[model samples]
Structures are given as structure tokens and as C-alpha cells.
Target chain A: MQCFSCGFNAMPGSTSCGRCGANLSLAKAPIPVTPPRAGAVAKRILPGWWALNRRMAPLLLRIGIGEAALPALAVPLEVVVRPLIAMVQRPVSLLPGVPFIVAGHRAPGWLLLAVWIAVMLLALMLHGLPVIFLLLVGGAIALHAASALQATGLAYRSVGARLAGIVTCAVMLLGLFYLPLGWGTMRIVGGGWWVVPVRVPASFPPFAEGDIIWLDRSAKPNLGDVVVTFRPQTLRRVRALAGQEVAMIDGVLLVDDVPSPWQSALRPLAEGVRFTVPDGRCFVLLPESYPPGGTPPAPTPQPTGGWPYNRQPMWTVVVGEREIRDAGGNWLPSLGSIEGRIVGRSYPLSRFGRIE
Target chain B: MPEDEDPQPRRAAAAATAPAEKDAAHWLRLADEQRRAGSHESALRFYSRSLEVDRTAVTGWLGQVQMLVQLGEYPQADVWAKKALEIFPQHAEILSAGGQAKCRMGALPEALVMSDGALARPGESAYRWLVRGEIILAQRERGDDHCFDKALILDRDWLVPLEAATACLFHNAPAKALKRAQEAVERGPTSPRCWFVQGECQQRLGMDSAALKSFSRVLELSPQHLEARGRVTAGGGGGMWRRLGRLFGGR
Candidate 1:
């Protein structure tokens, strides 16, 4: 017999529609998949990944930030993962790039993935005052694993409804995946050291101009310790770590209104300028003075000429967050981006301020 | 007199799903009946006859294209769609039929344009959304689940999911096809057509036992379902495992 609800061929005595779940006995005509208009369209097709992402946008919006931050976990997570990656990488170099493939990209994706990995590795190796990279790259791989596990676990969860609920729950737990891993790196790795050599030509009162100096890579600077560092070729001082307000009042360097002790050569232009430093960043005396204007001045790589290095007063130095890219996708300087400097105008002057 | 004059459409709609009506548009009713009875060639002839009876009836033109596509005459369908477009250029159903024909003929970019044209037209129907979803799936992207869901919301018919599953099954995505088929089953658990489609999808996915259960359900729901009966008997006794062994060739 015909099912009245959906016009399906059903058992002669059926009470409801087997096709549309409509009441077959209602005397109501089955709403066979008739178009609101007498339209005829054909067979339906399945969705693609690109379309699925569109469907999952709400969940992805919240997940995107955490996913973007997932690479950060690599830094801290690497403390635990380092051994496996390090040894395996010696024989099978492809192992480090596995996370990118797992997350779904191949060649071009590897380029960004490698850079992220480098950022995490640098955070671990630099031991800078702002050290979050350990939690990014290394932890990224771990985060993926954790989120994967979380998804599988949630799929089996009685409370969860299909893939959507599982994915939502999985993203909710994205950040927590790196915490314990970070703890292990913090508790076990403790800290390490780097002995850097330097030519302090100008700070002669503490030491001679040509005197060589070594600084610990992980140590917070102290009195008599030189901190102007640019790797093996150059050594720099950490002028002021994150929060201290710094000013050069009338050619005299002052930290928190007190005359500073470890002074790099002071600049004349920085007569009364003062500002507090932001987190994840530090203030360092620029090697040169900058002219004041609405438009910013361009900065050169480094003065080929030696010290009596022009001691420019200030540039609010910022950690070069992952946005260091040229139009052609080249990596900018790995060192911190001094937003106040006019370094090739890589950033918007009004927004990130000019690199002087 | 007013009661007697109460609209013919309401009563017709009440029996609309029944394929044939005693007093309806002459050739259009015959075309619908032929299409319903699974004779695409006969449906195409009747649709052409309806168009001859009334050239302004866009429904006959759409039916002609639909039946041509069903008969695998994609080029003819495209030609009809173009001729129909010349007459009713803004008709969403004609545009959608053109898109479907173009997609079947392997002209993806043209299909995309036609599908987008259908979507741009004002007359919103589940057909437009379903066509758009099919076009998207033809692009080999996997996100049309939402599109199909939207179509279902527009018209809560079991045929929507069944059609969606059939599309996926034809496109070599049995896993996804099975999901769509399951959606159909969810909408109409007792439907032999739904069960049959689900069984086909499951067979494609190599889920033999599940496919068997679905086939059995089809038979139970509609004892006269010849295809379901054939599938059940074909897999009867020892041919079951042998059929199951040809997993990849299921599609």
C-alpha cells in the first residue's frame, strides 16, 4: 500500500510513513519530495573539506586562536619531546616536520611550520626574559596529539553528540595540553648557560675598550655584567627588563628616576624621554640617535663603523612575534623588532610604531 | 458555490504526491505520472507534449531537462536548458537543471556559473540549494552536509537526503554517501527507498552486515520492493561472503 505521509510503497496496513515519518493513516496526502514549486533537480553530492570548514566556522572561530597559539606549546613541550625529536632527527630528519603533515599541509605549509619550529627553538635556546616559544612549536605537536586524543575520547563520551560536540570539547582543551609539558621543561630543564664574548670599547671605567667579556645566556644581568649582545660577533646589555620605566634626562640615563649604573653611551637627543616597557619586551639604548617627526626614519642593519658607537637613547624593543615576513615570504630579523625603529617599514608606523 | 469553487490546487496538493491526478493540467500530469513510474524516456515525451500544449509552462521545460539528465542525455538536457533559458532566463529551476546537466557533462566551471545563477534567482526552493550543494560537491570539497541540511530544513522530505546520498554514492565517496544515506534513514526509517539507498551506501562502504540489515529492512517495509528482494536473494546462502569480498568494486 502507498504510505500517505511521504507517498512511499509501504506494507498495506502500515499506520505511518516509513519514508517521511508522516502519519500514513491521517488521510493527509504525503508530501513527497515535491518542490514548493514544480521543480526538478537531480542527485545530491557530499561536501568537501573546504565546505566543512565553512560549516564548522563557529567552533573554528574560538579554536583558530588556540590553534594559532598551538605552535607556542612546542617550546615548553619540547622540553619533554626534545629527546625523541633530537635523536630521531639525527637519523630521520623528516620527523620534526611531521606535525605540519598531520595537521594537513605539505610543501608551502612546511615553510611556515619550520619558521614556527624555529621560533619555539629560539625561545628555548635564547632563555630571554620573555620565554613562551617553548610552549609553542614543541607543544604544537603535542597539542595536536592531545587534541586528537581529546577528540577520540569525546567521541566515545556518552554526553557528546557527534563530531561537532567532540571537536568543540577538544578545542576547549587546546591550551591545557601544554601546561604539564611546560612544567616538566621548567622543573627539569631548570636553566642553562651561554658564555658570550664582547668588545666593550666605550664602557671603559668598568673595563677597557678592547676587553673581552662573557655573559650567561640564561642569567638576568647584574652590576658589572655587560649585556649588549648580538651573538658571537656582538654583546649587548639588557637595558631594562619588561616593567622598569627608563628615561634619559639631560644626557643622564635614569632607571625609575634613579641614575643608572650599567649605562651604554647616552645620546643627546634623548633629553627627557621616558616610558615604561611592555611585557614580552625590553627597552634597549639604540646604537644611534633618531630625528623626531610624524613620518619615521629608516634604520640600517648595523653601523660598519665601530664604537664611540653613537648611543641613541631609546627604542621600545618588542619581541618579533611570528608576523616577520616580507611580501615574498622571507624571514625578517630573528632578533626582537624594535617597533619604534624605522627598519624598512615592515610594520605600520601608526600601529606598531616606527623602528627608529 | 464558493465551496465548490474552493481552489483546485489545494485538493490537488492533498493528493499531489500520488503521481497521477484525475483532473489536472493534461500533459503535465501525464509527465509527472511517467516520471513517477520510472520511465524517463516516456516522461521526456510527455514533458515535451506538455510544452507543446502550453509553451509558457516552465514546469514542462524543467521536466524535459530533468528527464533528459535522468536518461543520461546530458547534451540534450543542456540544449533544452539553453532553449528554456532563452524563454525564461531568470527561472531558477531551469538554471539549476542546466547546472546539473553541465556538471554531468564534465564542464565544472560552466556548471558552477549556472549553479550560482540559480542561487541568484529570487524563487527560493529546496531544489536550488540541492543543486548548489551538488555543484560544490562536484568541486571535490566535502562540506555540503550543511547545504543538504539547509535543503531539508526548507523541505522536510526524506527524498532530499536520499538524493543527497545518491549523489555522493555516484561521486565515489561511499563513506560520506553512507552518512547521507543514514540521514535519510533517520528521516524515514520505514521507507523502503530510504532503506534501499542506505543499503547501497553501506555496501559501497564494505559494511556487509549493515548493508544486509538495511536490505532486509527494505523488504520488510515494502514487501513488493523487487530490487531489495533481488539483493536479499543474490546474497542468500554462500554468495554473501563472495559478494562481500568484492569490497572496492562495491560502487
Candidate 2:
């Protein structure tokens, strides 16, 4: 017969392949030899039981009193138990870049080292001659007691399974006791403490969380502040505060005597438009997009009676009222009628850090 | 062979092997049907069976709690309410229902605490605030005016301040009563009790004319307004007749 697994030649009556240890007899079809008479069948069953005992007696005796089996089980028990104790006593790592010494002695690093040394010493004491010998003897006694108990039908398994179960349980019990403390130490040392209590502002649409802002907190906010306040709504910044009643003649913002230098910057945002910063308000303009290179555009003579500028609808800050409006001239109430003074910001401390 | 075969064995086998996956859905439907039939005891059984199949079914837990409340089994209701809260702490309906259960149990302090948590969530309903006001009134009735004042501060539109202010006219300092009542009226002008309070405060202050006018206005808005009508009649109102005469012809 050819064994399929290792392609080894086997004897015709062989039940297993000797080379690769594969079952070969299972592939053959069952062939009935003859019909059984009642008395013969009953005798066949009793003989079959006797035959099974004859085949199993030597194997059972060899295993039940085996000298090699004890060492084989003990080797595995030592291999599993020692590593588990070592794992519980292992040290935790601290933060990077910040030197360990400068980060202070009270940090998580020192705490883990002390625990690791104490556990290692305890484990070393337990692994010594008398302790190891006692554990081996105790394990064997427990196995024999469990086997005797199973023979009396109190349980199904012998003491070997019970001792393995006990060692596994002890490892788990020790792990449960120490693993959380070790993990907690590792987390503390990793330096994620800054995340505990920083305030994060609610996000409004169109403006993402990363936008840069310049906060102005001087005196009472003039029309410039209202323009800046509206910029969060418009997603743009205001660059110039053209004084009240400043006329924009031919795309230039002029505050009475001077043709404002900021007018050119404001042109890109609102072209060919003029707006009066209402009483108790100042006109705000976007900063110049184009640089001042050559001689500036020649200032044209101002018109006399009729103002040559068209008024564009823009936000106005009513001083006592403290109300802000959108460009469409409707009240936006949820922002609250009060002008919330620019107290502080909700932003990242570093480029890598998130706004909490 | 077919005639002799026993169907009972096949039936037993099928019963033993039926999939448990369908049990939760079946129990939930049965609970709904029982609830509709007004068999709350049976409904509770089915709902509990559904929960046994899936412990975290929030709706089933809430329904069972509400059914227990309807059955007046307050101790059991309290237990389920707590369990529902543990699952979804910020659920508004559960908080409100739990507040109601606590209120009925005369645990007003705990009820107010629960309602306060509910109100702190963004966009909580005004009805929850109203229940909180009731809890405050309960505290005030027990001679704890500080919590009542706090409730008024949390929700100025609460009607309890008017009732508490009227109670104050007899039991408390008149000045505090008048101040609280005036604030209540201003905060909730359309409220008949607010006007009734105004009348009570004015009468306490000996301003009969203003008191009479306030009472009259309360009656105009709510003709069956009991306290204001009682105050008017008790305070003696030939003044009311005189005003009536002026309205007709004989002023």
C-alpha cells in the first residue's frame, strides 16, 4: 500500500503510515464476512471486551507509573509559570526626548523599577531548592489525590490535569493582581496627562478648527471689531478701520484729509464700494492684497456735492446696544446680543497637539 | 407505517430544538400586544422575557419601568428607572419619567436633582423645567424656601413663584412675597396665577385700587380663576360694584 501523505510504501495490513504517521486503513471499504447467529454474537461481544483489556493493560500500566511523565509535565509547568511571574515584574518605559533625570525622581519610571525589583526577589526566593522541590512534591501529591478521588467517581480527571489547572489559575490570579497597575504606570509615564481638562470650543460650519485668528481687546471695540467679529461668519479678516464718515472716491478710502494707504488692500474684498461706519462705529476694510511697488495710483480730485461712492451693506456696532449683524441686515440672535469680549482662545498649544 | 407513527415524539423534538434567536422578537411583539390589551401584568412578563434575551434593550427597559409606574408598583418602578438611567444617563424621557416617579414617592429632593441633570443637557424641554418647579414648590411647602428661590432663578418662567408668593402673603414676610410675585408676573404675564399673585400682593400692601384691578383682569382672562375671585369677595368689593356701575351708566 502507498501512503498518500509521505508517499511511503507500507505493508498491506498496516493501519498507519510508519514514515509520516498518517492513517491508511480508514481509506478501505468495509467487507462483511458472514451473518452472525444470536449465541455467537453474545460471545463475540464478551471476547471483544477481553481483547480490548488485553491490548490496553500494558499501555495503562506504563503511563500510570511512568518515571518520564512526571518530568515532562514539570518542564512545561516551569516554562509557563516562570515567564508569567517575570512579565508581572517587568519595568515600564517613560517619555521620549525629556531626559529621565530631569523629568524627576517621582515620575512613573522610578515607581515601576521598585516594583520590578521586589517581584524579582520574591520570584527568586520561590525558585530556590527547598521551594522548588516542595512545589514538585506538592504537585505530584495533588495529582495522586485527584486521581484517587476520580477513581472513587467524585470527578472524571486525574491529578495531573488538576495540578496544571491550579498552576494556570495561580498565573492568572497573579496577572490580574499586577497587570492593571503595570499598565496604569506605563500610561502615566507615556505623558498623556495634558489631555485631562483643556476646554474645546464648538465648531461652526465653513470655518474649520485650524483657522488662525488675531484677537483685539483694546477699549470699546469700534466698527473695526464688528468687522472682525463678522469675519468669523464671512471667513475673512479685516485690515483697515476707516474712520466714521470716511468717503471712498473711485475705489479709494479717504479719511477727510488723507487718502488712506489701506484702501488698496481693501479693494480685493469689496471693490468700487463705499460704506459709512454708523455713529459710534468705524469703517473696516480688508488688508491690501497687492503690494505697494511703483509710485501709487495718482489721487483723483474729490467730487463736491454728490459723493462719488456707493454704500455697501456691512456690519455696524451700536455701542450701548452691543449688537452685531450679518451683511443681509438681519439679527443673528443665538450669538447672544452681548458683545462677548475676546477673553481667551481655544486652540492648540503645539502643532502636534489637538484643541481639546 | 404512517398511521402507526407517533407525532408526539416529533413535536417534542421540534420543541426542544427551536431556535432561541426568535424568542426576543416574539416576546417583544407579545409585550406590545398585551400592553394594547391593557394587561400590564402580562405585558411586564413578556417585556422582562425580551430583556432577558438582550439585557441592553433600552426601549424594553423604559417600557417595563413605565408599566411598573402605571401599576403603582413604585419600589419596582424606582429599580427599573435606575437601571434605565445606568444604561443611558442623558436620555431625556427616562430622566423626566424618573423625576415623576420620585415626585410621586415624595422624594422631592432626589427628583429635583434628577430634573436638574436633565435640564443641563442642551435644548431640554420646558416641561421638564415645569416639573422641576413642582419639586421646588414641594420643598417650599415643607418650609425650605431656599430651594424654591433657586428653582425660580433656574427657570424664571416657572408658575410656582406665584403660588409660593401667595402662600407667603399669609405665612411669610409681605415684602419678599410682593417682590417674588411681581417678578413672577413680569416673567409670565399671560399666566392667570401671576395676575392672581399681583392682586394678592397689592391687597397685602393695602393698595386696594390696584388689587381690585388685578383681580378684575384675572377674572377677565380666566373667569373661573378661584383664588382671585375669592380674594375679591373676601376683601369686600362695593368697589367692584362701583366699577361695574361706571361701565354701564350709573357712575
Candidate 3:
């Protein structure tokens, strides 16, 4: 006889379920009566689920594979995505120690929970795109396999009644999430690595739209290397280093009168301009416009959507070197303003590696 | 989700669903429907919904645990089963469910103990017998036929034999599974699922032509059966079924 409680089968006249150990006699009480669901919500909404799992999933199982095609696809949504969706409807604090609390010192799960809260506050504040952006990033880093008990240090919110929509939540969460954010940014800064989601002008080479810049702050800027400068705050390729003669002769870049690669898509000078790049200063120029799908991408590790949330810097400079035209026409930025050189992993699809 | 929150976290009421519409029995029906329809995830959510409406509903709790196991979330299933037991201690079904999880996790001895414990409980049922049979089969042993036979005797449903056949097949006993599959076919000759089971068992036993015929019969019953269609088209079947396969799959 088949055990109704848990689908176990046993010998004829067996008193109890051999698999689940339920008494065989009363087994029928709990079995959900299998009614033909004609026009039922399940049948209407998920015909494929019904057809496949009822048919395909069992076949796959008997063939030594796994369960439902829909369920297999839905696993990620159930484990990772749904909790995040539930967090939004969270009339309560859904992410106590969900994302951040890490191993002993810190954890990625706890931080992600904090990120989610921060994003919601932004949503309440009506900062629409940013909220969507942050949520997408948060949703992508789901913690279905997260270790729970290690996050005991996350009970720091005993003070208030915790009520707010996306805006007030955003403001409050900014301070809350930014507590760890400030520390994390500082940590990365001290560790000689700087990561930032950067957007640049269409004329800028290498950096793609929505590209993240990972800089090796400790590395010295070299010729043909793309580096970030703080003085004018732009990503520029180093054409002429200290004491190197740079001349925009007949619209050609000449480093010490040798034909250098014309890296900029902008017109920095009209006449045959020549100047000695002063010591401790490098002549910088925004690299040539990188055409989308023109060159084969460099096989870099970090894909487009990576570990999100870093200190953002506004990309105000459309053409930084041209702005220096009035001030003696020298586009040299001091070495101290040069924060760091862009690593190979910076927004890989474009021409970051090509600049060298 | 227990992945992050307490073992039995307070589920927030869904914003889109009106409170008046949140009937536990209705949700339970929907959960069962979804499970039958094949989306364990949907069923899992429905069970959660039912529990949200009425946490005391043991069926909802069991459904949640069963769906998790179906989705291969054995660890989560085990955890949920333990939580269920805390509320309804000595629940035969819950014990069997837990045993199923332990069996899946490769803990045969623990599973056998849990199964035995379940039988010692008062709620005698065929499901617990099937659970026992499953645990026995999982142990790579051959003495599970009696356990399955007891389940078949208790439930007399064609699905029981098919389920037993599947359990036997999964446990590497194709010959035994084939017998069970034949019994299932005898009980429910028109069911595409039974024919499909027979076909699979035939394939496992290396009865290639007979397996093809069984798959062909499945196609004739359920014209939309994709796997059977593939088998039919791949020279798995001949005669009238092949012509039917050409008629359906020609385009």
C-alpha cells in the first residue's frame, strides 16, 4: 500500500508507513485530495510547470537527473531573489544580519543586507534609478548559501521603532550603511586599491559606459598607461613623462619629436605647439574614442556587473586637456594629482589594455 | 526565508494579496495544485502563503517541507521538518519527511532510525510505508519490496505502484522496478505517466524494442509528450507509432 502522508510504499497489510513511519490506517486523513484542476489558478498561470513536472521532472528523475525544469529555473529566485523581493514589502526589518556579517571580522552577507536597506531608503527618497541599480546589484549577490549564526553582531537597532518609506529610509540608511561603507572605502584606500563606478564622455577611450575603474593606487604612472588624476579629475593616458618634450605638431602627437600615438579625439591645439613636460608632471591626454564592437575585447576577469557600491566621483571633464588651453596651453597634470594607474581589470570590454 | 531569518521567521503579509482573500484552505488547495502542476517553487510559495494565513495548518507545513525536498533543497527540507516536528511532535508524516531528507543526505542509518520512529507513532498511513520503502531502497539493499507492497496494499492507487517503480529504478534495481512499472500499467493502462515509467524501466533493463513500444504508447496517449516524441522520432519505435510520430513531428 502507498503511504499517503509522504508517498511511501509498504507490504500488503502493513500497519504503518515504512518510509515515514506513519500508521497505515489513518494515512488518508492528511492526503491533499488530488482534484482535477480545471481552470484553476495554477493551471492558468503555469501550464508548463504542470505539464513538465507532472511529466518531464519524473522522467528526468527516473533517468537519474533532477526535478522540474521550472523549479530548477526557479531555485535561484526562491532561494536568493524572493527574500530580496520580500525585503521590500518588509513592513518590518527584513535584513537583520542577512547580507553583511562575515567570518569573525566581517562578512559579505551582512554588508549585502546593509546595501539592500540602503537601497530601499534611496527608493523611499525617490532616487529612482540609483535604487533600481543598487537593488539589481543586491539581487545578484543573493545569499542562499549564507552562514546565519555568525551574524549575531547585527542586532544594533534597538533604538527606534524603524518606520520609513524609501526616502527617509534612504537618508537613515545612508548613515547606517555608510558606517560600514566609510570604513570599507577607507580600507580599500589604505590597501592601495581603489574601485569606482565611472562614466566618461563619448570621446574618452578605454572606459565604457557603466564601466567600473579598479585602480592600483600604488603603481607609478608609465607612458601609454591610463591613470586617474585628481587636479582636473579625469582619466587620461600618459603620453609624455617628466622632462619629455611634447609637441602638437601639425595635429600629430610628438613625444621628444618622435611620432607618438595620437590618443585624444579632441583638438587641444591649432598651431604647432611645443612644450617641455615639467618635472613631477606628466602630459596627459584623453585616449582616442573607442568604437563599440570595433576591437575584440581583452579577456579580463571582472565582468560588467561586479561587486557594486563604492565612492563615486562625478565625471565632469568632457575634454580636460582643452580646458588648460587658456592657462599657457600645457595639459600637464602634476604627478601628485595622479592618484593611480588603471589596472587590467578596469571595465574589460573596451580598450583599457589597448592604451599601452 | 529560513536561509537568513529565524528557523520559524514571522512571514510578512504580501502587499498585493488582500487580507480577506488570505484563506489558509484556499492557499493549501493552490499549493497542492501547484505541486501537482509541477512547479515545486510555486507550491513552496503557496504553502508559505497558507502558513502565513494559518500557521497551525500542519498540511501547509508538510507541503512546504515536501516541496523543498522535491526541489532538492534537502538541507532546508531537514531544517523545516525539524521546525514542523517542534510544533507537532510525534507527527508520523513529519518524521517520514525528515527521514526522506536524511536518506537524501546519505545518512542511511539516521534515515532508518527516523523511519522506524515514524512507524512507532499513532498516525498509521501509506505515506510512512513509502518513506520506509524509499529509505530501504536508498540503502542499496533489495529487501524493500515488502515495504513497497505494504504501501501498495494500503493505497491501492496506480500512482503508488508507479512511485514504487520509480523508487526501485532510482535505487539501481531495474528488474524490480520493471515489475512494479508493469503493475502500475495494469492498474492504470491509459495513464501516460505509467507508460512512460514502463518505458524508462524497459530502457534501464536494456529491453530497447519494448522500451520504444512503451514510449510510443505514451505518445499515443499524450500527443504532447515531448520526451516520448523524441524517442519515437529517433527510431526508438516503429509500425503505427512511427507514422503517428511523423504526423506530429513532421513539421
Candidate 4:
């Protein structure tokens, strides 16, 4: 055995180099190389694809190792990258003593984290080109390893510390590229997709339980858009668009003088509600029975006041299907209350398609 | 002492010292003393004895009703209020007590009627306004705030505001309850109910740290306040106290 520190050889049975007093066992032995079989020399040079596969085989293996190790490496990357996203969202004003930028619309702190995690998962799932990038990354890592081996003459002990700096930089670069590309794709294919596990067979025909839906958050909801709403969050079909006059007379909805087909299906409570869909406000007609999943009725405390005012427990309207007013007697949800429109269903292999 | 030097106060005063004073007023005075001394059970017993001596003793009737409400015996409170109302149909305080009981029992319409009748009567006190607030809250009316405001304005002490704050918290109007709780705390800084109400308001408003502090203050003021103790434990701040208690051989 040879001493890593002094390059002095020790007797075969010895633990340490006697002259240098160094631990000889710590030095790594050179890996043995196997000679090619004699029959292989008789063969002609391989075809292009065969040669290509040969080159790709080792690269693919290294790429697989990198992809497997990525999630572990991305943790430290998150801590460094998050603050940069925050800084971009709120630029530091150069004014004296001002630390953060003032912006009208600030993205939520969790938004970048969620986007990054999703993109990383997407990168892991994607193949072909990312593998090539990983191959280059593997080479870079090997070069670093070789440099460390020449200096220390042993394998690097601090795997995380040694590679994290380089890996994090690579990840940040890839993240910067991936985020915009993902965002553009999201924008084109509607912001995101969702699964509607609740099956409302009676009201939402053709759509059943556990159906996947696509959401285009940026798209303007129309009169017939089956939109997803936030606030008193719900999924409902839009019946009244902005600038349209809406009236709920005895639980019947009249949108711009046309009695909606939903009116006949719904049993609105006895309340005279009339309003013009104000600017940027649209009326979404929800299903009569809530929990859209057709679940059993959840016990809800009755709205105090009188028994007459107590309607069925629901997100908005408690009165009969015709009633457009909420438990507080507030009108139907406004457009500002909506999150996005359900562009289409994207799951359940058999019924996979767009939503009207 | 009674607010006025009227016949009732004179009778009460005479009853306190007179060797032969064996009347409803004497028992009522003893009940008030017990209540002031924090012996609610004995106070209730004295009030019952007073009411038995003289069923028409309006003060004794109101005292029994108030005690029942305080003890969370709403059904008993309702029965007592109804019995008191049969004798004193037009009494403002009795009507207010009835309204409070009815409101707590979920009889909103009847409670509203009683509260309205009480408010319509002249010489309205803070209790009547507080009852009105409870009734309005039960009715889910927007005028509940105005009712609480009136109670606070009429109350010379912090009791009305503290009770109203509790009622507001019960009705899920924590923002409005917070205002009343703050007023109660300002007026009576050491009152456990005020701190409890403040804690409840802060908890509902998502100010968990402030709520934990408020609940801790409540337990500090009244160590036997189980609700405050529950809030403290629920907020995950009671571990230190428990460990200290264990060190001191306390359960």
C-alpha cells in the first residue's frame, strides 16, 4: 500500500507507511482495466447508430444518477433562489433606507416555491434533451472529482458540500430557463389543469364524478363558461356576463330578458332580486344541491333570526333553487369572485376531452 | 347601595339592621352580599328564599333569573322569567331578563318582542340594552351593533360591555366583540371575563400570539377559569406551565 500524503510504499501487511507515518489504507488503489476480447478485433468498425448507442449508454447511466440525485440537491437551491424571486417581484428601491421594492401586485411567496417544485418534477419526468444536459453536468462533476483526487488522493468525503455549489448554480440556470418556457406553455394551454372529483349528474350533464378540468386563469369568462370561483370557492356555469341585466324573481333567473334553462331546474327562494351585472362582474349559476359530489348533506348551523330565513346549508344561497341571495341575503357571486374558467377535462382516459 | 333614597332603598336599609327584619328585602340584601362574595350557589339559595318569602319581590325575581343565566341553566332561567313576567307583566327589567333568557334559548322572535317591550319602557338601564343586543344578535339583525353601543353608553361600569362582548363572540362577530372587549378591559383591567373575551376575539381574528397572551393574562387574573386554561392549552402555551406544575408536584 502507498501513503496518500507522502507517496511512500508500506509492506503488504502494514497499516501505515513507516517512514512518513501516514495511513496507507486511506489511499485509493487504481481501478483495473479489462482488455478487449480477441474476437472483437476481427469485426469491422461499428455502424453509426451502434457507435452512437455506445457513446449514449454511459451518458444515459450518468444522467439517470443525476436525475435521481436532483431532488436531494434542490433543497439548498430553493433557499438561495427564493429570495431572488422575491427581489424581482419587489425590486429594492435605491432610495436611502428602503430595502424592498414597492409594487401594486405582489406574487404570493408560495407561488415561486410551487412553480419551482413543479418545474423540477417536470424536468425529472422529461427525457431526451435533459439527459444530454445531465451528461454535460456529469462531465463537469467528473472534472471536479478528478481535480479533487489529484490534490487529496482520496474520494471526496463531503458529497453535499462539494457538489452542491455547482449543482445549485446549474439548477438555478435551468430553473430560469424552465420557468418562462413552462409559463408560456401554461399560458397557451390555459394556466393549469384540475380534477373535479364531485359528480353533479343532474345539473352538469355529460360531466360526471372524478373528471379532470383545465383552467385558463387569464381567460375572460363568457356567458356559457363553466368557471371555477374563489372566495366562497365553487365551480359553476356562468349564465350572466358583464353588462347584462340579471333578475331573480321568486327563484327564477332572467338574464337579459331570457329565462335561463337553469331557472326551470332550480328552485330559487321567494326573493325579488334585480341587478345589472356591474362592470367586471358576471353571475355564475351554481347547481341546486351543493357538494357537487352528490355527498350527503353536511349539518350546518341555521342562520339565526327566524326559521323563515333558514335555507338549506350551502356556500351562497340557502333559499330554494330559485333564490339568488346568500344566507346573508347577498346577491350572486360577482366576476371578481371567480378564479378561472374550466377550459376542459383532461383526465379519465375514457372521457378525456374539452369542457363546454 | 341602591342608586336612589327611595322607599325600596329605605326598606332595604331598615331590613339590614332591624332586629325583627324578617322579610324579602332582608333576604335580598343577604343574597346580594353572597353574590358580591363570589358564592354564587349560596347567592342563588338566598335569592330563592327571598322569592319564596315574597313572589312579587321584583328585585328577588330578577336576582334569581340573573343567577340562573350566569350558571348556564337557560331552561330554568326561562321558567323563572316566565313566572316573574306573569306577576310583573310591564316591568322593564323583568322583560329584559326574559328576553335575555329567550335569546340564549334560541327563541329569537319571542326574545325580540320582549326586548322591544323592555326598551319601550321608560327608565331603561344598561341591562335592558344588553338584553336587546343579545336578542338582535339572535335575530341576525344588522342593528345588533347599535344595540351593543347603546348598552356600553348606558353602562356606568364595565359589566354591561363585558357581557355584551361575550354575546358578540358567541354570535361570531369577533370584530365587534373585540371593540367591546377592549372597552371592558380598559374599564376593568383585572376582570377575567374581559380578558377571556379579548382572547376569544384575538383568536378568531388570527392573532394567535396576542390571543395566547390574553388567555394567559386571563388565567393569571382568575386561576380557576377553566375556559382560559383550555384556551391556553389549546394554543400550545400550557406545556411550560404543566412542566412547572409537575416539578411542584401539582396535577
Best by TM-score: 3
lDDT tens string, model 2, B1-251? 49899999998888876855457677788987676434677888788877666544555666677566545454346656765665455556567657755554445445667787777766644345544554544444343355446657656553556544643553334555777778777887776667776776776565677888888888887898776787677552335665466356331
In model 2, the clashing pairs are A143-A159, A223-A282, A265-A287, A265-A288
User: Global lDDT for candidate 2?
Assistant: 0.46
Q: Candidate 1, which segments miss by more than 4 Å at Cα? A: A1-356, B1-46, B236-250
Query: Candidate 2, which segments miss by more than 4 Å at Cα?
Result: A1-356, B1-105, B116-178, B188-191, B200-213, B220-227, B236-251
| Per-candidate local distance difference test | 0.53, 0.46, 0.60, 0.57
Residue A28 in model 4: lDDT: 37
Q: What TM-score goes with each of the models? A: 0.36, 0.21, 0.42, 0.34
TM-score of chain A, all candidates: 0.24, 0.24, 0.43, 0.36
In terms of lDDT, the poorest run of 10 residues in model 2 chain A is A313-322
What's the C-alpha lDDT at position B239 in model 1?
58
Docking quality (DockQ) for each candidate: 0.02, 0.00, 0.01, 0.00
Clashing pairs in 4: A251-A268, A251-A322, A267-A320, A267-A321, A267-A322, A268-A321, A268-A322, A268-A323, A269-A323, A344-A355
Tens-digit lDDT string for candidate 4 (B1-251): 56564687677878776845667788888998776434566778888777666654568778878776665455456667766655455568878887776556454555677888888886858888888877666555577778778878877587677778877776557787888889988988877777877887877766778989999998898899887898888782345564466467432
Ranked candidates, highest lDDT first = 3, 4, 1, 2
Greater DockQ among 1 and 2 belongs to 1
Q: For residues A1-356, what per-residue lDDT tens digits would candidate 3 score against the true structure?
A: 87545566788898776765656654333433221112233223333332232343335445554333333433322232223333333323334444344233356656656765664443323222355556654543232212221222122122221111222334423443444666887888878665433344222444554454556688888887888777566777777899998776654567788867543434244346677877888877654322322442342232232223122212212333334555422367878788787764334344334234
DockQ winner between candidates 3 and 4: 3
TM-score of chain B of each: 0.78, 0.41, 0.75, 0.73
CAPRI quality band, candidate 4:
incorrect
